[model samples]
Target: MGHDTVETPNLSFGRGRTPGRSTPYAQYARLDELHSLQHPRSKEPAELSFIVTTQVMELLFDLIRHEWTIARQALREDDLPTALAALRRGTHAQDVLVESWDLLGTMTPQEFNSFRSLFGEASGFQSAAFLHLEFLLGNKNAALLTMYDGMPDTQDGLVEALRSPGLYDEALALLARRGLELSPAHSEQRYRPSEEAAQAWRRVYTEPEFAALQPLGEALLDVAERVTRWRQRHLSAVKRTMGGKPGSGGSSGLTWLRKSAEQDVFPELWTIRNEL
Candidate 1:
């Protein structure tokens, strides 16, 4: 019992052979390239957090956009379960996106000032990914496309998104297919909250026949509410860091964000809740 036995090392592959360049996980993730992208402009210590957080938020924005696009396509195909799943995934992405501000929120006005000038004309308001997300959520402002005039591909895609059917459009179409009297024109036009649409949602909630749509409506509402909350958090962050200053991208900053936040994401969903 006192005698010690030799211990053998556990190696899945050949001894001393580490997972090399052929590793599928590294190849698929391209983590090396991803990690290489963060080059902050200033020597300020806090700039690193700002840079990485913005990059993370941009990546999350892409994920949210992808999921919402999947949800819109699913809705178009009359697949409620698949659409709900995608919307739920998108909400998770939004949750992370909203929390991302906490990292940058730690930066004070003086800290941000160190590298703020390095930003020049760049600002979160100019984020094309976020603009695309807003378009998909049924808030299309064609004027914003002007901001990307130098980027033809991005501008064209945004124009197409502006004309395309949004998530709310597909939701209304689903309701129409189920015998609700919603106009197809709502799919292309800037959406306005209508009394008739509210009544339809009321039916979806109160009537047993339309019960299947209840969860879809609630999921859509959940997304809209989360988006609004994210906007509120964004406004708060900007106010805390910059206070009344104009955005580096030539926008009105907090005033503009405040007005923008007041604009509802899915208007009919909230309007319907009043009737319910």
Candidate 2:
């Protein structure tokens, strides 16, 4: 038996440093700047854990957003290879995010309580970038846009994503182009399943053409599964640490996060899987 993986070479900048051996990785590596970060409000040792976990999550979220953007762009240009690379990035980032929750899990109730109030009305729900990423993934909830209202860049970005058809929309459209008879009813709204899309995907899986696109579909599914896992793991962490207490940012904490955990990233992509 044999296996294959797609490799997308990146433009990693390093000056005369060996790939496998470096005395101080950071010294040899490139960093834009870190001067503005790591400002822990409380002088508590545990506060560092809370702040670092949040920052790590934010970084992972940024990577997810980047990959989804690449995936969307790939669909637009009919560049499935590029799209697959982007989706793979999201899949890898999802693993990192789940681990971040594990880091937060180390903070016991007493540890969290010391610095929880310092967070003020700032909960993960209020993360505008995260919200925009959700909308880009085809989850449109108008109410979630409220937090971005006063912030122009975030508001504009999310509003644009909401109006635009998502990555899956482009994929279904591609299937239609590839001769799937997608009924208008199937795609009208609500991210419902498409018989045509499913059939086309089935053909792709059963008799794959455009060899790279096979991995494209798989990569998308991988990303979806990993993201869902991250959510589920985070919810477990929250429940373990805080129980049903309200979130520091004013939401209904664990209960509210539980509902968010159910939100799907690419709904139709998963629906097509059963038919395949």
Candidate 3:
């Protein structure tokens, strides 16, 4: 008996694709291009792990930034439910970002040293995606923009992010719209804790009238706490792998990270707890 062959249907799974020729998963995900991105500069087997993990982190940073941007935009429109949903998603991304340190947390000093030289001035400090996340979180530092002077497109993007109203800024604006008074925050400056902002948040926690905003305040705090955790985990991972040595990107390594980890992400949100 002869068996008849069945022809596969030509289905379009992604844009501009010959459907029957390739696996839809690979084509849609562009897995070939993503897998091709890891070009380790050294023969050390552990180098690939480091490079892959770093790339994974950069992708997560971009994801979290995207969520925060959505939240900021939603808050600008006074859509509390939408803003809270986006912030909750951002915190979940931040949670994964913190846990990603597990991939590199066990790197021995010798293993890192084996490929460290190959990195040569390249460092996570230079990650534009992570910097954008920082700016969106209101950690603006104009001096850091100088680092990307050679990369004009990246610098331009960072300049735009730096000048845009941050996630916290929109939250405050929403509060002001609801009859709470708050001083305008400087878009291009690093976030500073203000008594006025703290008092506003305190009202959210204590006053029955502003009780509707309590969830929004809590969601913002959740995001801030996760960001602090991510920074602390980064500091811990670097300390264990490289000790007090200077960073590959020309910063004071552990010292700089320690200072950064110590700083709260949303200062007023944290400070308000003392009074509440």
Candidate 4:
């Protein structure tokens, strides 16, 4: 008979490489799984680099979304330090995503064209988690939501994330907690620029006492800015590979991505920056 047993990660926490350096079974178990994830369609050697880079970026994006979710909850609860920690984690994740792009940028146009046909209908457009991340950031679109309905479980996760408040929503809530007036409607799933929210953030910027929240605001902006950079670079890559062509996923390629890049996730977060 098999009994229920929970496996714990055997990690050696120590000061230096001398004590905790050699982790055999535990390290091997995780790394082996990571190694098996890449299955590129093409025999071309460079395909491995492209596939691995995209996968790594996706993993980083998942981590960032998770951290932001936690941070948003913490801010909603008026827990500053916990919110700050999560935001810091998110910023670190953003850095990793940007660096992953740099590695992918190494793939020449010829190399991408080699594997492009093999990808068929598989595009970054089909990344369910990425769509959910976008929806979580209050960039919800009915068309995008419908794309996931065929995949019930994926659609469910996205629906939940969409209904939840974003990092900006929580920040506005925090301002309200700090005696600043913000409309209740600002917390809704659809993003709309609130003149009142902007005024509140402007006050927070002017006051030294609200400096911690200011840093939190700037950290959120850093995340938004980096993500925008990623989208732009992705568009650039698409143009470089297949100039003015339709995407493999049935979109207008660079044109679609250009429109997407123009849409800001947390609109008021950026608008407030101008006022501040």
lDDT to native, each model: 0.86, 0.71, 0.89, 0.75
**Residues 1-276, model 4: lDDT tens digits:** 389788554443322335344457537666545766889888889889888888887888789889988888888889888988888888788877766767666567778888889988788888887877776677766567787778999888877777777667777778887888776443334677778877777777888776667777777777788778778888776777667878888988888889978877656677776655
Best by lDDT: 3
Question: Compared with the true structure, what per-residue lDDT tens digits does model 1 show for residues 60-166?
Answer: 99999999999999999999999999999999999999999999876799999999999888898899999999889877888889999999999998888999999
TM-score of each: 0.90, 0.78, 0.92, 0.83
Instruction: Give the winner by TM-score.
Output: 3
Clash tally, candidates in order? 0, 0, 0, 0
RMSD of 2: 10.2
Task: Indicate the TM-score of model 2.
Answer: 0.78
> Candidate 1 lDDT (Cα, whole model)?
0.86
Q: Which stretches of candidate 4 lie over 4 Å from their true place?
A: 1-29, 186-190, 208-212
Clashing pairs in 1: none
Error of 4 at 192 (Å): 2.0
